[model samples]
Target: MEHADEVYDVIVVGAGIEGSSTAYNLAKFGKRTLLLEQFPLPHSRGSSHGQSRITRKAYGSRDFYTQMMAEAFAMTDELQKECGEQLFINCGCLVIGPRTADFLSKTKSCLKRYGIPHDQFDIYEQRKRFPALSFRDDFEFVLDKSGGLLRSDKILQAFQRQFVRYGGVLCDGEPMIDLYPGTIVSVKTTKGLHRARSVVLTLGPWAAKFLPRLGLNVPLQPLKITVCYWKEKHGGNFNIENFPTFTMNGAAGKHHIYGLPACEYPGLVKICLHHGPNIDPDNRDGVENDWVLDAMKLIIATHFPSLEKEPSIVETCIYTNTPDEDFVLDVHPTWKNIVIGAGFSGHGFKLAPVVGKVLGELATGQKPSYDLSHFKINRFFKTKL
Candidate 1:
C-alpha cells in the first residue's frame, strides 16, 4: 500500500456504486481522488453487487428523481460507450397497481409530464398482452418503454475501471476505522492514515458508525431485504426475453412487491418484498425473521400462478432507509469539507451516476447541478449541526 504524505483532492470512503461513481467524476475532472473499500472488489457484501437493478424514470411522487433519471440514463450511455460493453438492457417495465392507488396515478402523471413515452393497459389489454400475469379486475398497468434492467455488478466494475483509467487511486480491503474532521480531513484506515482536502462518505448501512463522530444524526435504518427467486412452472415463461421488469404498488399492505425477469438463474424469476426486518450490517446473516419470505410466497401464489409457490433460491441485501424514503445528499452539518450520501432506501442504484456527480460537486465546493433541497439534512432536524 502506497501511503503518500501528500493530501488527496478527494477521498471517497466505500467503493459501492455511489462512491465509485463519485470517484470517477472527481478523477475525470482532474482531481486527485482515492477510493477506499472495506472488502475486496466484486464482493456481494454490499448492495452494489447485485446482478440487476430496475432503472426507470417512473417515480411516483419523486419527480426530481424522474428528472435526474434523464441525466442518469445519459451518463449510463456515455459509460457504456467508453467501456465498449453493454451496461443497461432496455427490456421495458410494467407498473401495475390498483386504479385508485396514488402511486400509480402519480407515476402516470410524472411520465406524462416528462414527455416520456408510456402506455396504459386496461384489464383486457393486460390479459391479452401478458397472459401469465394474474391481477385483480380493477388493477391497471403502465408500460414504461424507457425503463429496464441495469447490470449493477457490471456497472460498478466499469465505473471502478474508468475511475482508475482517469487517474483515481483505489485501495481495496482497507476499512476506514476513524475520521479526523477538519479543513484537511485525516482518514485513518486499517493500514495507514491518508489525508484529503475533502471526504465523501458513501457508506451504505455502516453510516451510523461514522456519522456520530462527525457530530451529525441522520435517521438511517438498515434493513435486511430478502431477495427471493421462484421457479417458473412452465419453462421459459418468465425469462428475460419474454417478461419485463415489474412492480406491484401497495401489494402487501404498506410495502411494494417488485420482480425482475429471469436472467441470473435459469427458469427462476427474481421476486422480492421491498421491505424487510432491521438488522446490523456486520451481523446480517442468521438474523431471525422470515416474514418477507412468507409474504413473497403468498403474493406469488395469489398474483403469479405461473410461478412456483416456493422460492428456488433465496438471497439477502441491505437497504439503508430514511424517514421519508428519499435520499440524503448534502454536506455535513459542521464540517463543510465532509459530504454524505446515504439513506438510499432501496431505490438508489438506478441513480448512482447522478448521485456520485452531486457528491463530487459538493465535496469540491462546486454548486450541485440539480435542486437538492428535497435531500437536505435539515428536513430531519430543525437546529443546524
Candidate 2:
C-alpha cells in the first residue's frame, strides 16, 4: 500500500516526546516535516506514557544538563502558553539522601553554579518541613525550587497538536519497517514509503533493533522498570499541594528510589526504583520483575509510614540506557542528513526541548547552539557506528 511519495523537508520517526518535540520544532521553523509512530496515539508501549515526569534545572552529575535546563524551563512555559493549557505543576523537586551523598553535594553545587533557587534542610528541619514520611536514618533534603512535575500525557498531546497546527504531518500506528539513507532518505513504513530530505530517529526502545538493520550499532540497552503505587493509609499531607516530587538516592548499595505525590492515581502514591533489569523492548513482559516490587515494598515500609507496605497497583515503563547515562544526540556517522536521538537513560523527558531543538538544527543543516561534545556517538564506549 504505497501512497504518493510527497517528499518532505524532514521526516521524524517515533511520536514519543523526543520525536514529537523534534517535529514540533521543525514545524515551528517552517520546515515541511512528517512524524511517524509505530504504536497508536496515547499508547502505553513506551517511556512517554508514564503520567508524570520531573522537570528540574539542577543535575547531580551533569553540568551540561544544568545549563540546558534554563532553556528547557522557558520552553516548557512557552509550550504551555501555546497549548492554552496547564502542562506542569510547580511543586518543586526534593532530593533526600545522606548528608555525604555526592548527589546532594554536587546538586547543591550545580544549583549555586546555575543560580537556580534552592533550599537545604537539615534532618531535623526536613522532618518539620515534610511530616508525611519518615526516613530510615537521618537524611538531609535539598529542594530545587526550579523543579516540578510535567503532565506527561498533556505535554505530548500539546506537542502533536502544535506540530499539526503548524502544518506538520503526524502519522501514528504506522511502523517504519526499513530505512534507506542517502541524499533524500526513503522511510518505508507499513502504510507507505515517505521521502524526506533529512530524517531524525527517536524511536525509544525500538531503536536498539532498528539501528542494527541499518548496519549501525550502539550501546542501547532497554530496561523494564516496575512502577508501583501504594495506598495512603494515614490521612496526612500526601497530596501534590502538600507533598513535592521527591527522589531518594541509595545510601549504601541499595536501589535509588523516586516518586510523585498523589498525581497518577487517587489515594495511591507513585514510587519505584530508578533501576531495572535489561530486556529486549519487543519482549519486555518476559522478564521477571517481582524482585523490584519487593524492593519498593521495603522502601515504602522503611520510609513512608503513611502508605501501605504492599503495592496496590503495579505498572511498567521502558528505559533505554547507554553504558554512560548521557544521551546520544548526533548525526549518523556516515549519513550527514540522518540525525539520531537515543539512550535517554530515563531522565530525558525534562530535557527533550533542548534535545529536540538541537536535533532539528542538525537535521536542517543549522549549527546547534549547545555543546554536543558530551552527547556525541564517538564518546560511546562501544564506539561502533
TM-score leader: 1
Question: Per-residue lDDT of 240-293 in model 1, one digit per residue for the tens?
Answer: 787789988867454688899999888889999988898889988868767788
Task: Give the whole-model CA lDDT for all candidates, comma-separated.
Answer: 0.90, 0.88
C-alpha-based local distance difference test score of model 2: 0.88
- Candidate number with greatest lDDT: 1
Clashes of each: 0, 0
> In candidate 2, what are the lDDT values of residues 47-126, reduced to their tens digit?
89977998888897788888888899899999999999998899999998888788889988888887888999887787
Runs of candidate 2 with Cα error greater than 4 angstroms are 1-5, 251-253, 381-385
Instruction: Give candidate 1's whole-model lDDT.
Output: 0.90
